[model samples]
Target: MAKIEPGNGLTSAVSRNILRGTTESLALTDGEGNSFGSDSELNAYTSERQTDKYGFIGGAQQYSEQSAENIPPEVLRQREAKWLDMLNNWDKWMAKRHKKMKLRCQKGIPPSLRGRAWLYLSGGKVKREQHKGKFEELDSQAGDPKWVDVIERDLHRQFPFHEMFVAREGHGQQDLYRVLKAYTLHRPEEGYCQAQAPIAAVLLMHMPAEDAFWGLVQICEKYLPGYYSAGLEAIQLDGEILFALLKRVSPLAHRHLKKHNMDPILYMTEWFMCAFSRTLPWASVLRVWDMFFCEGVKIIFRVGLVLLKCMLGSQDKLKTCQGQYETMELLKTIDTRYMQEGFLVREILELPVSERDIEKEHLASVRRWKETRGELHCKALPRMHGAKAIMAAEPPSRQDLRQNPTIIVELPLATKSNGEDKERKKTKEEKNGKKNSSPTPVVADLEPSKPPPPLKDTALLGSNQSLSSTEHDTYL
Candidate 1:
């Protein structure tokens, strides 16, 4: 991606780093499935040899993965064993992952486990030495230096079409902004990324700012590699991984996804991004989060694969729609009772998943996610416009808290005011004198202007209103 100059005039080095943040992270997972090392190794590798994924012209390391020998049997075996043990006894495995232990998550966790579970799952259970109390206080105030820019850009963009996030200026938007800014200040390194909004939004719902920041740090570090990148290749790579898994589990869906260039990662990105807030209900999100924190990143893939198969098997014929339509539909259906059933999780586990199932589930989920989002947003154009018009027409509340005080002012005392001023003051006092004496703000629901009285020549037996009193409360 080309660099867009930041409106904020950051120093050359700071701006460069911010621009390169995604590139730096992507240095770990380039295109063509070649990983230089874990994210831990990305800093050293990128610093020594600058540049990024798909930019390979003559780099030896970038091209080596294609020619590299198949992963050794022992390494694959250890990976399988490690993964199997985790699936069977998640609590035991996760206990070792964290310095301070957390219990296993519920049998099936949702996608909104971005905070508490994210931290626990990413080995961030222990207290961090940095930004303890400061992180907590960041929520109540305004204007944090680090996050103000990043947070402002994505106010409701992540799931802009979700009605829950549609209000132009409301509680959800405010809280999201506060939590994100706080986290950015708290972790100047991770700073803020475009993908952080969903995760931060989920955390703001469950936790105060400080804890949420720590939890976010943990998830980005341990559970997700794509979260903090410039171009977000981790999403593509992980989606490919899910695509591979789905093929093993469901061939029919695999063919569909392949036809449309769909992948399970598209459906599950929100799950990885915010622990599933975009996909699952709050209860399910937390439930899944509980397990996510207890298990590891693999659980995200496993549960997602499982959910895909379950959602597919449901109703024999999977629901049909366009790309966005299917994703939007899936988002709506994510909270249905069918998903909450315990047996579904067991069913996914029982499937041999032999590569083919994973591929199919991955594909079907891709289509479904696109459909789900379409319904959540684009389908609601009339309602979205209507809702926005209503919100705009309504009187705005006086909630400005960031205004600076101490402006120059030199108003004369009452005795010095002109007659017009005195008259105006008296009229204002008379208008408000009979109301409640309290100084606090008052909000009144107003009715729209009524039509002028009918012409005298055509008068009826009694005066009539074009609209009833109930109609006054609403507008067309």
Candidate 2:
């Protein structure tokens, strides 16, 4: 349970600033006052920081000082084998035995297959195939200046302590910018949201930019709609729902929050908006995301409740929180013991909050909101939960299934020359007792000897990397 402090100033500062407004003063500069963008900058900065397995700077401990659970290699092998079969027959599994898929995801997606698993789980793969080359088309076009500037300022802020984002304008930052910028272009009305950067950065960690872009799209449009929109109405609704559920799960904690006038927004904005990427340890974050993508927002709600229960559920825990400041401090500095990935996940699963419960709360919250704030402005579309639901809702077509079609070239038939044919006829006649056939010189046997043309993978021609090489990706 290697619990690093959730807020090292990077996630919280950037999240708050982006929520309000972007400013020029927020740009991070190097020792010489030069803004970071070069590979040289990344090389120099990494020398000063120790990265963890997930590549977060200053997050690792020496082997002698470390005390973390290690998944046995045999267990990992078993899980990887199961994941490989699921990935190979994803459609069949999604169509038939999606319960098995859910169980596996709950257990934890293998690190190597996590990217592909996320793509499949989120339905991003189908969406990507359906809209082939759209990301590239959008990436090629000039991004909106307002969004571009804001995106650039916020780029370095996401996972700044992580190896992926440690360098200014490094490959990680560059991909994050493209994903966010292309998203702004894709949905100009929605524009850019700072919360999206960390989510996209997480996706990029598993997959490439184009896959990550679609993953972001699914998050915004399908999984958690209106969350990053103008008013963040969806998240507000979810927050209310969370508070409402807390009242049932832990009345003591709920009463404490009520007494302090602590709204869910005060703490859960980063937790829900970033999908707990900022709040949990690296392994815990990945585990949460694995379930989040598969099961949708309920996992989020469950995680929040678990935290509240652990923090202020009982009398002993609640006694220390005498006031608002105290309670908030307790929350901000979440005890590492509660954050252990295995324990946290087990608590989340056993919490017993279901989609029906969330929906019932949602309806109640909606009625309350309508009474208080009048008619809702930003209405989110009804979305399906879990991979199976998404699969059933938007079943991949044959075209979508054939994302990478193989090309097979048929070889030309060999043919004998005229001279060779004559020699063969004379030899046949001599064998039939016609001895007058002189030894006729045989022409060399001719065959179409050239090998079949090299197979061409058309999909690679328009891939994300081919659209824009890293060398040409200049930072602003």
Q: In terms of TM-score, which candidate is strongest?
A: 2
Number of the top-ranking candidate, with lDDT as the measure: 2
* Alpha carbon deviation, residue 65, candidate 1 (Å): 51
Compared to the true structure, candidate 1 yields what TM-score? 0.44
Model 2 alpha-carbon drift over 4 Å, by segment: 1-38, 59-68, 402-476
| TM values, all candidates | 0.44, 0.78
lDDT per residue as tens, model 2, 1-476: 01112532123433452353212113444554334556667567667756566766543211112223577878876787787677667788877888878998998887866877888899898998889799989989889998898888777666656666666656777788889999999988788877888899898877778888999999888888888776666777888999999999999999999998887877787788888877777778888999999998899899999999999999999889899879877987788778778789999999989989998998998999889878776777675676777778888876665433122234342354789887787687778877654444432221123322433444332112322322111100
**Clashing pairs counted in every model:** 49, 0
Clash-forming residue pairs, model 2: none
Output the worst ten-in-a-row residue range by lDDT, candidate 2.
Answer: 467-476
Runs in model 1 deviating more than 4 A are: 1-104, 107-125, 129-150, 153-175, 186-191, 263-266, 313-337, 341-476
Worst 10 residues of 1 by lDDT: 378-387
| Predicted structure 2: lDDT | 0.73
